[model samples]
Target chain A: MKAYAFLKNTPKTTTPRGKTMMLDKGLGLNETEDLLATAGDYLDYAKFGWGTAATMDRELIEKKTAMYREAGVIPYPGGTLLEVALLNGQFSEFLKETQALGFGGVEVSDGSTNISASNRKQVIQQAKDAGLFVISEVGKKDPKLDHKLSIHERLMQIQTDLRNGANYVIIEAREAGKNIGIYDADGNIIENELQELAKGGTDRLIFEAPLKSQQVALIRQFGVGINLGNIASNEVTALETLRRGLRGDTVGQL
Target chain B: MKAYAFLKNTPKTTTPRGKTMMLDKGLGLNETEDLLATAGDYLDYAKFGWGTAATMDRELIEKKTAMYREAGVIPYPGGTLLEVALLNGQFSEFLKETQALGFGGVEVSDGSTNISASNRKQVIQQAKDAGLFVISEVGKKDPKLDHKLSIHERLMQIQTDLRNGANYVIIEAREAGKNIGIYDADGNIIENELQELAKGGTDRLIFEAPLKSQQVALIRQFGVGINLGNIASNEVTALETLRRGLRGDTVGQL
Candidate 1:
């Protein structure tokens, strides 16, 4: 059903297509329906993005979640909301509210707050036990704090999150995709860091690639099957084009 | 009817609220409606960026333009598309096609092509004669070429375009809003250049400010009555909040 179906390039490898996690900063119901109509099949998860869900009415959030669910895309609140709830000693309430809001998943991240390793593990298990898909993020929102954590530490956290029952582990690049996790200050990927992180295989890893350059680099490096996250809602179709080698960046190269 | 109307700040000056021109690269019908529903009152123009209008079906573009017009916002094709049409010697056809497509306006820009000042004046006049709203842009798309244009030259061009019947003259910053016109490489405004440009008065100028920082700074400097263009579709409501002192950036200051 693609517009230019005849121009789609065959995959260079037999690797299956990867999951795409879109960042929904704030979208109305009509906008959500529009997204699904155009690029629903290409998306796997929709993250409400860093406390943005809290800014809207609960009914609107529920409607958005239901829409995503109807389209088979798991909808989840941002990890920062969970962190805020945890700070207020309302983690259990947050989980309950997340379910009531029709969210099918929960992102457990310590990006903005300090959570002990044991607590982080428990948080992942709790969300999983609550019949929600758990995606744990590894890295800090603060650049200075992020720099303090070595590659070895990030890899170990990824391992721990997977063992603790997270469905996928996401590298933290935030929305801007610059100077965080595997990306440099200019938003370019650090090849050595990316290589080290991919040592444990990439099937369960979602690299938060918001920029087109990052998406192209990651797709080229890990084949089209590399899970990518933090994509802008409008760029969903464009990303699918890159994945399918329909875009100039990956045309004939994939 | 604003969500948090009680918390709105009073304007510091009696200047009327400025116009906002959102950049619609390629939005579907549902997305367009959602935009109108949430931020219709805040918008004055909707630009189908670059030649993206050429990429989609004619019907879809017509539907989008109709929707925008119904919401009281003028819909126009990007200036680059006009430049493309001029290169193909399809200027008249382009104007005819634009009207058939339901676009209320046309942008005449030399951002991506070279058109002599006289020809540029003709282009503007032709669009005006066609009963279309004309918005002329002043700046080259290539950063190097943009940098070569002196502020005095830019001012002269603005004067010429206004004289030629342009309803408004946009100081081009392109979509990225970086290293062009009055903005520096980091997307920061060169205060002196902006000051120089504003000497001819800013009432007829539309500054293409895509970044939030730029929007905040301009609102701060120009008392929320500075016409801004090239805003991202999703940021329309957020920009309105900034303009009305609802956002933190201009809350107390405005």
Candidate 2:
């Protein structure tokens, strides 16, 4: 039971809450266990942030992934690690290592690198074949390259990835959540861009709303069930509060 | 031993690293232990931010504080909680409760409320009298009110707090660190304001720098030993890297 439960008697909801993908950036064994113990119920997926998994001990990553799996959250290596593997022509080794390390999922993103369209589909299919949950990301790491992609092009990629068996196509906001994908430079949602992207529907799309305002905006826009990704580990509990209208921002509004 | 120790063979520094004060906004017992285990050596103070202490179970807070103390870091409730206590005429009770909860320090400030200079000094002396390490803050929480404070006035307050038995005085930048105290709207440090405030010297002052840019700028300006506060809990390791020139931003510079 939550402390101060009497203050707000939130009605039980039949509608399921949106999936929350938390960004795990270099958390030690103790930190990972603590996160699982505290806010594990609130998270659905945990992404070991860009190239961070490669920096730690194989044993540590395995233990962390086991902890997350035990908590009912899917654990995945960041796409940048995969991108790095592809660049080195070691994608097969990367997949074997990911499985050996006990990761339940993998993120396929060309954020920092490039892959031909045909290759992107093959990669997604390969991950799926390995019995791993595949989440393909759309958008570039660099804002300059990201801006060059038209709305039509983005929609086409989203459609292609979904058809290619990507579980969820993430609209990349790159942690900072600014000047990338559907967000403007100030980190605010460009409504038209967001709407255009959502035309294909939001169920299979996870918006990387790392900032609080973006989380609130997306939650408000899509009701309580909008998938949000790249959330800081500390903000997990707070995000759950926002979704349930326990926070002031969505208290009466939600 | 650190991972990737061979990439950068950092020289042993006889110079003491800066005192880092981390902000704790409602971390659980497990999470607290994780923080201590992962980055406790990098932190000198763990501030339970802004009335968050009041929101948790007494047992939980006690355990958290004990963990911090065992880790050799001073744990304190945020000044806003003390301010709230002062508002409620519960200073003595607050002090008793703080000690009972095992907090090693207390922050004295009128950020969200008003306290006369004499009363503020009395509060600091009272906490010191109770055998608590006292850190007095020197600015308002509101940006407008904070801006109204002249650099001279801030210096006077710092001197007064130090004289009144404050072990350290913090220049308030709040959590956001933008448009408050010496920072401009863009969160960039205003050189003139900072220089004026540091006229008497900076050995005894803790600047609340939450942003990476602010941390880098302050470290660059004042060397590695300048005291900084209000750092997000997760960034403790990252900040230590910056201080030691392990990160790209300060690799060669530091």
Candidate 3:
């Protein structure tokens, strides 16, 4: 049973919350299970952030992936890892290792590298073909370069990725959620850009809102159902509190 | 064995790191064990942030505290809880409960409330006499009030807390680590204020550095052994990277 179950006024999110897609930077096996036991019910996808997956012991990564799968959350390597694989001509090998490790999904992103437009589409299709749910990201990792991409360009890329077989498209905020994608330098959301990006419904889009203020702002703007990503693993329960109007920040407002 | 043991050039700290004082806002038994398994060797203290301990079930808190204690980490309730207890005249009860729950330390602070000088000193001595390591914090949690506290006042409080038998005095940066303490609005360190605070050696002072830049800055300035506090549970290993010169920011610098 949920803690404080008697608080019936806590908004029941009939729609599964895309409210939490926690970033599993480098959690060990015990940490993975701990996360499952603590906030598994609140999470949807767990992304092993950046190129970290390529750095850890393969066996440990496999165990962590299996744990996430067993807990019913989609487990995926970060897009940066995929980008690294692509850069090294190891995309196919990476996909095989991904499946061997028990990951349910694969992210296709060029956040820290570059891939041709045709290759990006082909990679997404190949990943889908490999039976992994694809979560493609649209933004450069570097703030200056990320800002250089126009809203129209990003929107087009999102549409293209979806058409090419991405289950969800992530707006890249890297892990810090600042000066990239929809967030400004102070990590605050750029309202106009966010509104433009949300021209399409946000049901399949995950905005990486790692900062608490960013999380609060997005939750307020799009209600609790907002698909938020790059949340630190520990913040999962805290984010749930905001969605259910349990925390002080959203209690009266929500 | 360390994960990247082959990365032999990673600067090993000859000095003990104060990187262990992590903020546990709300963690259960499993999460506690997971943290120990992943980073226990590095941690010296596990603090349940704010009055969160007062809000959780005593049994659950007991289990969590026992886990931390068994792992050799001194577990303690946040100073705000002690402050609340002092406000309600439940200081003795609070101390009893803390011991009952297996906490190895007690934090006494006037962060959220005023305690007369005598009361503050007495509280610190009482907590110490009760056989708990006393770690006192000095700062207002509110930004405006925090700004009013001149550097001299904070330095004096640190000295008083230490003289009253505090095992270590934590510079109050709260969990956000910005605008309220040695950091500016952007969370960057204000070097002059930090230098003034650290005029007393950092060995007895745990600077609450919750931001990556702050961690890197302090680690660079004070070497790897500098005591830090309010570190998020997940970032312990990441902070270790900076200390050991493993990550990009501190790779060559440290």
Pick by lDDT: which candidate is best? 1
Q: Which tens-of-lDDT digit does each residue in A1-254 have in candidate 1?
A: 65655653557235688999999867888778889999999899999876556545566677788999999999998887677677667788788888988999999988877899898888888899999999999998778889999999999999999998999999999888999899999999999999999998999999999999999999998889999999999999999889878789999888
Ranking by TM-score: 3, 2, 1
Which tens-of-lDDT digit does each residue in A1-254 have in candidate 3?
Answer: 87667776576445455547889877877777767999999898998766455445566767787788888899887776676567657778788878877889998987767789999999999999999999999998768889899999999999999988899999988778888899988998899999999998898899998999999998888888899999998899899888888888998776
Residue-level lDDT tens digits of model 3 in B78-144: 9988998899999999999899988999888888999999999999999999999999988999999
DockQ of 1: 0.09
Per-residue error (Å), model 3, residue A62: 4.5
| Candidate 1 CAPRI category | incorrect
Ten contiguous residues with the weakest lDDT in model 1 chain B: B1-10
Structure candidate 3, residue pairs in collision? none
What lDDT tens digits, residue by residue, belong to model 2 across residues A172-243?
998788888989999999999999999878999999999999999999889888999999998999998898
lDDT-best of 1 and 2: 1
What DockQ do you compute for every candidate structure? 0.09, 0.10, 0.09
State the lDDT of candidate 2 residue by residue for B99-157, as single tens digits: 99999999999899999988998999899999999999989999999889899889889
Better structure of 1 and 3 per lDDT: 1
DockQ of candidate model 3: 0.09
Instruction: Quote the positional error of residue A102 for candidate 1 in Å.
Output: 2.5
- Alpha-carbon error at A100 in model 1, in Å? 4.6
TM-score of candidate 1 on Cα atoms, chains taken together: 0.61
